[model samples]
Target: MNRKATALDVAKRAGVSRSAVSLVLNGRGDGNVAKESQDRIRLAAQELNYSPNAIALSLRNQRSRIIGILSDEVVVSPFDGNIIGGADDVARSRGFVTVVMDTERDTARDASAIETLLDRQVDGLMYVTVGLKPFEVPQGMLRVPSILANCYDEHPEPQLHHVIPDEVKGGREATEHLLQLGHEDIALLAGAAESPAAPLRVQGYREAHVAAGFEAREDRIFMAGWDIDAGFHGAMKLLDDVSPANRPTAIMCANDRLAIGVALAAGRLGLSIPADLSVMGYDDETRIADTMVPALTTMALPLREIGRAAMTTLLDSIEGNTAEAETTVETMVPCRLVVRESTGPAPTR
Candidate 1:
């Protein structure tokens, strides 16, 4: 069996002292070692396939160079996987590795997951969420430089850093687009009331109406789950019980799934999308949104960007580069409006 090459092998091949090779490789040889000797050492190390011991180097530097990620069910969701991908990409580019764990949204498992990552000597931590929700920053996580992604702490400590989507702007943009198309009578199919995204979106919806010089009808808004079923049911209530004169000209769904449901409901009622009624959704849900029959016009949340920003913040904190005097800092990434075929000019009665 071939033995692994050592620093001594590199030094021997370069005809230099082992210490000289070490100094050159560790970036301290500029003035101490002759330029010719440093070049020889580098070439010899490459030829010998010799590399420094990461463990020993880390011990000496007091840094593990590993970032720990804890998520609440993000690992299992196809749509949410971008968060992990983004974080991993940035960590790798910065010469760090990532260790990921999914807590499955079980608070009971958070402590153990965090403890295990801590035991691994991770230099920093990132807490990610599959959806926008208010969470409690785990107490144990405070031991390391940490950041939250796509989620925020309801009552944050000064040390917490968060990167989340600007749902309010996204909501307003979606509604404003419909309004610009001459639709003043619009219905909102909102997501779960408990979700942090829900209220922010509602606020934006109201803001858009106010800006357009129209008072949104309170009865036109329906709160429901962030799913196709809730959207279907909500649409039924909005379209079935109301007379045609009272029916909204457009429906703004909190998510693509709900928008799809509204489309289906519209079809059942013999209404053509954008011709009889326009529909808009949030969270472009690329996989579904663009493929729908009419294609959904929606707001695209910058999920992957949020993940990357969170990692960047955590790395800054780990390196003592943050300038904030407070313990917590919040950052919001804005969503973009994705125009598609589902939305159009309001139908003339």
Candidate 2:
């Protein structure tokens, strides 16, 4: 077995003392060690494949250089993996590593998950959720530099930072897109009324109509589950009762899944998308949105960006870069509009 190279070996190869190698490698040799000597030490270390002892370095600094991520659910879902990727990418670039623990959305496991991370002596913590909602801060989180991602607290601590999507804007954008296509009579297939995202999106839908100098038909807005079945049922309800002259020309679904449901229902009814009716959706759902029959026009949540921002905020707090006396911080990330083949100009009645 090949023995791991040591600073002593690097120093001998560079013709410098071990102390000199240590100073150079630890970034404390600047202004003390000669530039040529530093260069020689680096070259020797590279040749020997010498690596620093991370544990020893961490102990010396009194920091683990590891960030702990405690999430309500696995961040590896098709709609959420980007959050983990984003956080990991930023942490690596900043010379830190991440440890993730999923609570499986079980409140009973939250305490245990937090304790496990704390035991590891993580430098900071990030409490994340797969969806946007309010969550209670785990006990002891306030004792450490912590941040919230894709979630917030009802009564946030002044220093606590939150990163979340702008649901209202996303909803409005989806509606506005359909309106721009000259669809004056629009229907909304929204999510469950109790969902936080549902009301915000509904507000956006109404705001779009108001901006266009019209009021949305209250009867045309249907609240249901955030699924294809709900969308199908809602779309049928809107189309089945109304005469062709009074029916909506466009439908704005709260999510891509719901929009897919609408599309399926429309197909069964022999309605050609955008020819007989137009459809728009939110939460881009990358895997499903672009692969649909006519594809999908939707608003994309900046999931990865939200993760990056949350990690950045937590690091800033840990480094004392934020205002010391600040009580709370809320960071709203905007969603982007992805135009696809599912939406088009309203057909002339």
Candidate 3:
């Protein structure tokens, strides 16, 4: 095997002292190291392809330079992608790397994953679950500064930092958008009860209607699943069972998939989008939203932003003394509605 280049080789090629090469490459040089000398060292290092030993550096720095990640739902949903990407971006800038293990949505698996990350000697760790169900933190992780992003809290006392979308705000904003387009009879096709987001979203729907001084119709509120199939069936029942006057002028499906399902069902009934019925959605998953016939007018849940915030919090906790405090934080990033061809002025009889 070919041998790797070392600092001594770099110094020899640059005609400089090994100390000079080390100081310039490590960015720890004082004024005694001339800019011209530094340039020569860099050029030599590049020419020889002298790579620093990360393991040796880690030992010297007393760090693994690796951030460990645990996710509850990376199989069925891509939400964890945003969190990981956000964290990775920050980690790279700080010369850190990441390691991840999926918990497969099981609590036992979650605990085991944490243990694995711990065994790997990660500088810090993050554990993420999809809902508000009180998840027990990986035992003994109380000593690490951890943060949760884009999901609700399981821990009531919440000893660590948490970042999540403001579901109530997201829900109310979605409803208000429909109302702005002159929709009074708006319906909520919600997610399953397992979704902690469901009840908060329902609350937002109600608050919006109340703000408009229109009593929200209980019949119009449907607790459905988050999938397209659920929306398909729910929209059918809502459309078929209600009186013409009582039928929803607009519908807010829980997520983009559900909204697309609503559109498909409405289309099957020969109902014109925006003219016969308007539909709105949440999560704003672009894969489905951008391709819809009229395109989807949906509420964006700030998934990427959730990832960004969680990363910032994790880095801070990893590098700062703040991690040692008993502080608990809840940050609700803003959400907005994107109006597309799907919504319009209410149809007149």
TM-score for each model:
0.83, 0.83, 0.80
lDDT of each: 0.86, 0.85, 0.78
lDDT, candidate 2, residue 157? 48
Report the C-alpha displacement of residue 343, candidate 3, in angstroms: 1.3
Report residue 321 deviation for candidate 2 (angstroms): 2.6
Give the winner by TM-score: 2 or 3: 2
Kindly report which residue stretches of model 3 are placed more than 4 angstroms away from their true locations once superposed. Answer: 1-57, 75-80, 131-133, 241-243, 321-326
Across 1-349, the per-residue lDDT of candidate 3 in tens digits comes to 9888999999999999998987666444446588888889888988998856768867876878788878888535665466677767876645578887776777777766777788888888776555433456666466565776655445767666678878899899899998888988888898887778899899999999899998999888888988888999999987876577867889898888898889989988888998989999887676778778898998887766776777767766666524366456787877778888888888875
**Pairs of residues clashing in candidate 3:** 134-154
Worst 10 residues of 2 by lDDT: 152-161
Candidate 2 CA-lDDT value = 0.85
Writing each residue's lDDT as its tens digit, candidate 1 over 319-347 gives 65566675557898999999999999998
Please write out the lDDT profile of model 2 over residues 100-126, one tens digit for every residue.
988777888888888889999999999
Residue 316's lDDT within candidate 1 is: 63
Error of 3 at 213 (Å): 2.3
Identify the candidate with maximal lDDT: 1
